[model samples]
Target: MQFGPFLKKSLPKYLFIIPAFLFVVIFMLYPIFYNIFISFQDVTIMNLKGDKSFIGVENYRQIFQDERFLLSLKNTVIYTVSCIVFQLSIGFLLALFFNQQFPMRNFFRSILLLAWMTPLVITGTLFKWLYDVDYGVLNYLLIQIGLISEPINWLGQQSTALMAIIVTNIWIGIPFNMILLLSALQALPSDVYEAAKIDGASRIQSFFKITLPLMKPATLVVLVLGIIYTFKVFDIILIMTGGGPVNATQVLPFFGYELAFVNFKFSLSGAVATIILVILTVISLIYLYLIRKEESM
Candidate 1:
């Protein structure tokens, strides 16, 4: 009788978890397994439904030899690093400014977040026009201000194409960093600053010595999140440049999309996707390690 009661009580609890567990298995685990499986197979639209014969590491070898893939990798690194640096620096400064008591602080903060709130497609399209050679407001302003003698084609040239997208991404990412860092700044004890002032420390010394060290954890969070977000940027680049101007803005995600959909090289696309997965995984693991170490201390 006791055993029967225990079983009845536990069964409902287990049943409650079944839907969530099954959802994860079907949506998350299944797709990951399928991708890994096809990465080792020679799968294409021609034989997508007929055959998925294993080809060992042929896909990997081919991608390594591919010049476009190498270019995409290089572009990905440059885009990610540039976005992170600018986003962090600009966002931190904004956070510091808004954290202070001032007139219209909340109003200005909301205005600052408008860029982040705008949809990526809209932002991309808006920027594409802004960088237009003839009718762009940006070019008109620059010429009027005597910054340039002529309208410079921002997205139409290989030299400026990548930089254009990087600037857009940096703008989109700054609000996220600002909000996170602002919260950290608010949580810092005011007494620490008061104590520093008593010790004859200037504002600059207090910022470097106390504020920076205390904000390290929040900074790490912002950096890791920025890396992951910028590493997989797609829609903005797609709508803005379409990885164009001689593929100057081709990053890994766009490259993978082109390989799979445009070129119909499913196996090669899978390899590129796998490389991206590995990079994100490594960064995630490092983030977890740092979080654990921080907590232990």
Candidate 2:
């Protein structure tokens, strides 16, 4: 009798999850397994050869020896950590500002969404134009204002190229992060502030004690997602510099593309992809564990 009732009640929820379940099974899970299989065998976009020999760990071994792969790993980690730090800091500040009562709040918030809602490809292209050394608005304006002795190559030299991409990504990311964090901030109870004020707690004290603690969930989510998204970055890199002027901006995703399509090393590419997946998986598990621990406290 209990089983029947529970099944009947959960039936609607099962229907709701069906589309998501199917999507993961067909897209995510299958592709991952297929990629693992692909990594074991030396296959390419054209080769119809069926000579299959099990080369255990050879692909991974090649990955460690490849300098580009190591550099890509280093670059991906730097880009991810940097993006998370700046994006979270800027986003939290903006979220706090928007959460407070202000004149024309809605108008300003709508304006902020322009960066978030704009297509990333369009943004990448726009930045590419902005960073162009000659006849570009940035160089033109800087030169006119005499900001520097000469026009800086924003996306050329190894030193400035990664920074340029980071600036563009942070600009695109901050608005979306601000919007989400703002929603969370608004949901915080006003009564908590009142009680803190009664205790003679300053705004700074209350923010540290109440706001920061409550925003833990949001911070954790953003940090995890930012790491993942930054690791897989490609569009802006492709549009802005294409990892040129040396390998300054060659993060993992672009590295994988260069190996697979540019160099036609399909087995090596698959191994690199699998390694990336493992790293992301480990990070995700750690984040989830931290989130659970936070909630428990």
Candidate 3:
């Protein structure tokens, strides 16, 4: 290989990528390395005792053995799955609803995007208030309708605490999915719908045979992106329930926080974070493979 000629040909492209490469190296790669280093050593905010000792796999082993860590893992998995199901389902229904010519369609579309546009912290606080046992809109409405005698402790109860957070996440997530799916629905060929109508295909039948299949790409995109978002969720759980009502809403990110800050176990926290990174990478690859498979067909 002619090194000089290769450099001459590829230098500009490399130059173009230099800024992004530097960014990744400085922000992403550096922090990843730092975390990995922290994972090997026993670290603390104060005395960095046991700094020199190399505790190989001890952190990983400890996290696995800990009941809290195990519960956090299970909760993370359940949270991801439940968030995906609810967001995708509600989003698809909303997409279908808006696909038809409706009054104030543009207004409704803007409102949906507005919800997604609001800051995460703001959303979390609002939801926290809404889930409050003593004074919440949900309980008030339910009471007015004679559905419940007393206000339900939405975030205070172990049974409903996790579910309350999931509901908020779904609300935060649905708008994005709806917008993407709505665009996809609009792009679908009207001729197909017309032909189906002529063939006496019912609305439900046309939706199943034509609409759903065409919306697969949009659905896939939403599902993968939503899963990623929900999996990494921290602020909502922290603000709403503090991963509480006895750790019912404790997902992986919150668990990482609790381990590192609350327990002051940097090594174990880093190990758990690294494990989460591996899982996320695997999930991303699977999603990419499925998307490609669907695209190829």
Candidate 4:
């Protein structure tokens, strides 16, 4: 085929991608680059529309020095790590259980997805009432079960506020993790398990030697995705605690939001947003690398 003819043949195929390419550039890339630019400028409500001075890295410096930022960072780490660990562990166990032949297995799995399907705002609002110090079913049940003699201020006390949010997030996350893992488990080769059983391998041994090794890729994908989703949590905190109880449940996204809207520190908020972008970018790169490695294997 001549080069001219080949080019003409492929031209139409390439033309079809232009709209999607332009959409990404306009909506996603443009906003990201604009935010990065704003992060380097001294933008505030006073100078938002006027001449904004380019004070490179000053906003980042100020953000680092701010005590609330540091506290929110700490809380974010705690919340994300806690959610991932509990969500993965519980979800894995649930997947394993549901993978077996059992009565009403599909029904139970479908019901569990209600928490994940519900909007985060609604879930947070529902949990807010559930975590209420008084007239909350959770505290009432705890008291009835003799776990505590008093109604614990789950969302009002700083010590328990973050934990309460973590629990709520975990509940929301579990079904997602379970569904992904269950799909992976069901796709696994049954012949391998049969062979392992023929070799007199115990269920635990088969799981450790066969199941875990095969599930590594899916598990890692789920873990990284869980981190990405959990790290950017905002609405839940807004509805449940508003980062209150002395900023106990404050997280990075909410902190950035507060800086921009409440404090009107647009530059600082932009810096915070850039930081989150960088962190998630690194994570995404890791995920891509893992996927490539798995494919190579």
Candidate 2 yields a Cα-based lDDT of 0.88
Q: Model 2: clashing residue pairs?
A: none
Instruction: List per-prediction Cα lDDT, in the order shown.
Output: 0.93, 0.88, 0.87, 0.95
What is candidate 1's local distance difference test score? 0.93
Give per-model CA RMSD. 1.7, 2.5, 2.5, 1.7
Model 3: lowest-lDDT 10 consecutive positions: 44-53
**Highest lDDT model number:** 4
Q: Write the per-residue lDDT of candidate 3 for residues 174-258, one digit (tens) a residue.
A: 8998888889999999999999999999999998999889888878878878877888889888777888988888888999998
lDDT of 4 by residue, 59-140 (tens): 9999999999999999999999999999999999999999999899999999999999999988998998898887999999
Runs of candidate 1 with Cα error greater than 4 angstroms are 1-16
Instruction: Return whichever of 3 and 4 wins on lDDT.
Output: 4
**What's the TM-score of every candidate structure?**
0.95, 0.92, 0.90, 0.95
Flag the better candidate by TM-score, 3 or 4. Answer: 4
Residue pairs with clashing backbones, model 3:
none
Q: In candidate 1, how many Å is residue 241 off? A: 0.9
Residue 72 CA displacement from its true place in model 2, Å? 0.8
